[model samples]
Target: MDLSMDPAYSITKSECVELCAGIRGEPYSVSVLKEGYCTAQSDGTFRADGTISLITGPRAVLVDTGGPWDRELLLSKLKEKDLTPAGVSVVVGTHGHSDHIGNLNLFPGATLIVGCDVSEGDRYLPNQLAEGQPYLIDDHVSVIPTPGHTGRDVSVLVKGTSAGTVLVAGDLFECCADEDSWRDLSENPELQEVGRQKALMDADVIIPGHGRLFRVHRTPLN
Candidate 1:
């Protein structure tokens, strides 16, 4: 069934509150390496970039490395965390977009998870992301498939966080105020809408692909 044409999905956008929120958890602390942005240039072109984040814990995970232009900044941020490219145990590219995974070469030694593909060098690690299953990283973190903006998008769900559950969602949400913009940029708006609704339901805080962290405020049941 195509949910895009369904009335049930008519108001799928969540009630969100944009804020500079911090999501800290035991064994894992989430930090935004770079808050992404998209702006119109003087020309017809657009200046767009994806968000980058560091999830520090027993196994350090880097989410969305930003574009190649952010290499220096990415390195600087890692140094601030007392980490080098080698310190990152895993690099997750939420999708195949250049703005999201351009700097992946910086972490050659790290396990690469691009969409549903989990690989280490030439060897691929099999998982069930394509089957709607989440790949658990530990007791607190898991990478769940949430395809929408692209056919293979995924998000990192960090449980037991200071802000409850923090989802490092890629373009699953263009931004907190993206209700009028996401569908235009999505490859499959229907699927993306489903993913967005699920994220809003499951996470208390969401780190979007091109904006600051936002809190999801669900209406209480009567």
Candidate 2:
């Protein structure tokens, strides 16, 4: 369980920003605000409208945008932080949930990055598939694709001496302990395995989309 030795432990230099409601113990600084709620899915899952800002080098990246109710709040928060939608280098929607893509229209200058199965012509405008591909957000950081939650979901991984390797799990591991919530991989096995492997891998820090940030404790896995 030596995370440092994990293949996923590779590093690259970059600026980082967490734009969601503040996670309790995460490394990046965040601006917190009560946003809106996403529409309920047929499965009855509901997501709150909160976001995190990750700034790397001279570019700023927004993880997920809160819902319509908080679009103004997001804009205000960005203003408070001296960030403008026009200044954003990229927008990473963890998944296609309304809560995550609400303010996507705000970033006219940014290239929208989603999972491989996502359609570029979809509502998220200017969408592109991640496909586990690496995007250089300058010489410092990259947005690595790790789809699971939804067919097109992806996460952001930041690299820096101060941060080491940080994984923005999106919904990949909704919370720090969600790795154990799975029963078997038979249902959508590939996604389950991907999520499991990511959780088992070592990361200096894990930034979940909804819950607080946490450090992983090593657990032996077969």
Among the numbered candidates, top lDDT falls to: 1
Provide the overall lDDT of each model, using Cα atoms, as 2-decimal numbers.
0.85, 0.56
Q: For model 1, how does the per-residue alpha-carbon lDDT over 1-222 read when each residue is reduced to its tens digit?
A: 221332333323343433353456887888888999988799889999999988988989999999999999999999998999999999999999999999999998999999999999989999999999999988899999999788889999998867788899999987777865889899898888888877777787889999877877655433
Q: List the lowest-lDDT window of 10 residues for candidate 1.
A: 2-11
TM-score of 1: 0.90
Off by over 4 Å in 2: 1-47, 117-131, 182-190, 199-202, 217-222
TM-score of each: 0.90, 0.67
- lDDT, residue 208, candidate 1: 93
What C-alpha lDDT does candidate 2 achieve relative to the native structure?
0.56
